[model samples]
Target: MEDKTEEKKVISIEDRIPKLKEERKKKANRRLIFYLTIFFILIACVVYLQSPYSNVKEITVTGNDVVPIEEIKELSGIDDETNIWMLQKRIAKKDIEGHPLIESMTIKRSLPQTVKITVTEFNIIGYTEEKGKYYPVLVDGSVLKDYPMSYRGDRPFILNFDEQAYMEMIATQLNELPEHVLRLISEVSWEPTKNNKNKILLYMNDGFIVDATLRDFSDKMKNYPSIIAQLDPKEKGIVHMGVGIYFEKIKKK
Candidate 1:
């Protein structure tokens, strides 16, 4: 009876081994969680202090000029008092596009509370010589500005399509053209005859006229660099490479 009593006393506490291990495991888990939480909080605080949320420390502009800096800054609503940590870059980006001059904008936030704004301004592709001031024609065909006009430049004249869609199509194609070919083109007259987007008249810079049809457009253009090598500008003629490729001349100017 004495042995049984002592054995029971020892076994009673010892039998709860599973429970003790479980308690230890739970305690360890809680400690691990606490440490991780603390670590994350420290990281967040460090990041916050380094970011622009502390204040609008600096505003930078790149790949932009058409849109005035003051206008972009105003639209951004960024000030020296702004919390660098609390700012959302997308909000500023959307606001920047509100300006007529900005075609697209990218806003990025950098360390030390700086806002880096990268912008793509719309190209001034076509101009109308009106009132002795050159009114710039937008890709969407809406016009802006009243600057002095001169005919000495190689500005392409837009013809054929209506103002709105024409502006966009031309703007898109301008970049795809070869730099050499682009310079040679003095005027671009759109002669879209039902389902033909490629029909155009290129009044070349060398005083030569190109009567071209759009078929094999890029290929034909590639051929032209070699072809022009053989042709001369002094030989004034309709360089008709349209349907049947050849040249025809006017008797006089």
Candidate 2:
């Protein structure tokens, strides 16, 4: 006896072609969308980086007294509209420190749109006479060319000295003196003794003359205030420190 069997139907490739093409089309569309999304994100990032929000809009300067704020700003080369992200702080510091007055400097970034510059300047110790102008002498033993109408602060006048080394030595010695002692000095002259080229003559504001050598100026000058305290203030004389510390009163003529 033959049993009844059910037949299975097979789908032809021609009939499945439309479904395969549709699946491939969907995949291509998905890939295209992914590429377009990445491209848009990259473009957005570039635009954000170039916008005004990424630039330095404000600058603050501090720790400066003698140098003008405008001068420091100009030297730093950092101003409004400068890109904060692209600023090289080290380079800017080097540039600002090139000014002879600036002893040292520091640069810092304060968040998204601000920069801060701090500077320390060399102290002006005295003035040197050249031709008819009085050039500023710094504590570092360097002189400035620009001659102001008048010198600021109480500083000693360096007179009759052409030797740079001697001038520098005088500046170094004066720089190390106490503020009180420095104020007592009215003039400094390079008066070399027959025995010593390092000898100097100082005319004190108190009508006393100091005979000292550059080699021992700083060490010996420190005792000036205490030494003067022991002397008769009414007696104007010469204080000698070249050989030994002594005082010689000038006789009234």
Candidate 3:
């Protein structure tokens, strides 16, 4: 009987030696390429960070009316030589907001070494005199200790109200009025009645007085220009709007 068992093939380590070497070479090449790529990236980062191209070349300030752009830049402590990557936005914001006129501020980094600083400043609607000093009142009912020397004549002078609350109410109301109506106001005085504590009087630049309450001062005062347009421009009198909207011409003696 012939043997039916199958013969097992003999495998030699010498025959597989070339394949093993090829696999090892491929792995080594891959590892070397990876290490070289990592080294190049590290070098590139160092070069970019150390170069002057990474430094802030310009800073633009926007949304500033009361505070000067130079002042804002100075307060931020960032200049052309400042590194854009090293700038701490929170710290810069805090510094810029330290100004009495600035209400809020934001700092942003623009590409190619530029920083933009946008600020929202408190609008000085009018001025109120306390004691001998004249303080500028902001839209948010905040009074600044520094008196405006140049713009004093442009804003209305608030008088006869000693309480800060009343002054704040007047400021808030004036802030809500339109720019045309605000420009028409030459003076605002706190004249409270027995019935309404928010009563205030507005003296117009067109030789007319407005009696309005803080409850609806903005809504009622907006019609002032139209009201003036309807009446005789030469006539000077009180335009009553506290209780009901009407015109009361002062009788000439």
Candidate 4:
């Protein structure tokens, strides 16, 4: 007979345990690696910020014709020493647009140190002469009182406009005309007539003269090409555009 008093041996759960200490060690290592990566990234950023690479190496301006590039750059107040990351775009834009001729401006920063400035300038419609010096007139019908140009190019001349109101009115009328028509006009003189109060005379580059008023000058002048086509090319005359359009031949002067 076997000894029945021997206790049956039972297995503990040690084999089923999930190795908690090893898993904990792995997690701690992963957390350390994450923290180290962030620290290195921050250090690199600081180093780069302190280096010369953060400075603006180049600045460019575009869409500028009348305003000199150097002048625009000077007005922008941005240079090689300006930190690209610290550039104030709005401030730069405001500074550049402070120029009377500049209508609008835009600023952009290119990574790794480049800044680009683009500007749109007001159109120079014509010129007004004073004391042998000429000042440019803008499309808005205002003369650059403080700015005098060295020369008058192909732009038409506004002459004999003693009254500021008449000058402004004529400028507005001229602005409405087409570019081709504008080029044909050499000069405009304020010549009021008894029958017409706002009468003006236009001396055309093609050797023809136009007599009209500020009231409907643009409306009637737009058909000038078609009107002149009906006349003899060799004949020089004054085109009267009023209640009726007629041509008065000027006898050989």
Candidate 5:
């Protein structure tokens, strides 16, 4: 009878009901915590948006020269009443760069209540005179007509360059020349000969004059320092760089 006996084991749903209930409770509790966190975050955002602390309280401007600080600030279209979080960086940049002198600009947010603006102005290469007033010339060969004033002689003066196209070419050439060569030039005049339409006269600060054509002007001027070094410093004369390089002495009166 013992050899023939068999045993059976079974589990009922009631035995597993408590474990399933515990697992479901844990999942529901986690879901509830997640919802509460999201709800609190949304409420905090709304409160912050309505608070006065989110408004811009300080504005800073830097890297500007010809354009006045006050004028740049006014052009930015931003003020203390603007919300720091709602600032339109592109709009502000466009408005500020609309000025002729402003080449580019950048806007940055410095946290809680500060906005900063930086600008880069065009490089002032020289000045052109019109009606006894001097206007600044930029590297791009544009003259600032609205900024006419007295000449300080800090930069070279462009004289008798009525043709805009020629002036632009000359500006490009000057930009290509080395800084040392540029500083030595006090004045540039359009002195065309019957045979040469591009002839130009450069009045040097060191009392010497340079005669050359606009074509290859930058390349030729590179050797000017070496040429001047070989000449008698006390004897001022015209250094001809066209056709052949030679020095014609200015006879003492």
Candidate 6:
């Protein structure tokens, strides 16, 4: 009877505690994984909504003319109140491209916070006079914009020529003008009054005039100060600085 009681007391772990504990552990691990997955899903959704593409907070302008900043924004539909993330570069480019005055533009971003605009201005070749009104000419020599009578009177300019044609000839030369000559020039009329082709009048501040043909204009205009040095500054006369630097100085009548 004692031997029979000892065999019964020796219970097998397979029939009880070990199996139960393993089942419990599997259930607990599944629960933990479920909770972790839910947590990460919530985090990913939040991140996606708050990313750079969803919003815009700042707008900046650089390399611009003071006159066009506000106007450009209006035309571009890029309002001060608009979000940066909403800006589309292609759309913006299309908007401003209509304005002939604007040469080029580039847009950039600052993370999720800001947008920047960079601009390059049109090249001005000469100036135009219409019914005593004056306007700056673009590189193509077209009238950039109109001006009033106050702009007229003794400005040197390339005389009447097609705006587009003149730009190719005169734009580079205008850029190369010396600081002294540049300052002294009152106007640049395309196609002069006398046999207008290939000729321009550069009116000087020192009461002299330069009849400069477009050919070798940069070189001719470069020597203008020395040309002015020999002239009588007080007299109202024309100094021909167009071809080979000739100064026909005449006293005021």
Which candidate number has the best TM-score? 4
Q: Which parts of model 2 are misplaced by more than 4 Å?
A: 1-57, 138-140, 146-150, 251-253
Query: How many residue pairs in model 5 have overlapping backbones?
Result: 0
For candidate 2, the per-residue lDDT at 252 reads 96
Which should have the higher TM-score, number 2 or number 5? 5
lDDT of 2 by residue, 34-118 (tens): 9999999999978977898889988899999778899899999897778888888878889899887788999888987999999
Q: lDDT of model 5 at residue 129? A: 88
Q: Sort the candidates on TM-score, descending order.
A: 4, 3, 5, 2, 6, 1
Model 1 per-residue lDDT tens digits across residues 10-62: 99989898899999999999999999999999999988776646787798888
Model 1 weakest 10-residue run by lDDT: 146-155
Provide the global lDDT of candidate 2 against the true structure: 0.84
Model 6 weakest lDDT span, ten residues long: 146-155
Residue 11, model 1, lDDT: 96
The C-alpha TM-scores of every prediction are 0.56, 0.69, 0.78, 0.84, 0.75, 0.66
CA RMSD of each candidate after superposition:
7.4, 6.1, 4.3, 4.2, 4.7, 6.2
lDDT score, candidate 6: 0.65
What would the per-residue lDDT of candidate 6 be over residues 74-128, giving only the tens digit for each residue? 6667754555656778988777665666778888878766777777767554556
* Candidate lDDT values, in order: 0.70, 0.84, 0.83, 0.86, 0.87, 0.65
Candidate 5 lDDT, tens digit per residue, 189-234?
Answer: 9887799889999999999999999877889999999999999999
TM-score of 3: 0.78
lDDT of 1: 0.70
Better of 2 and 4 by TM-score: 4
Single out the weakest 10-residue window by summed lDDT for candidate 4.
3-12
Ranking by lDDT: 5, 4, 2, 3, 1, 6
Which 10-residue window of candidate 3 scores lowest in summed lDDT? Answer: 1-10
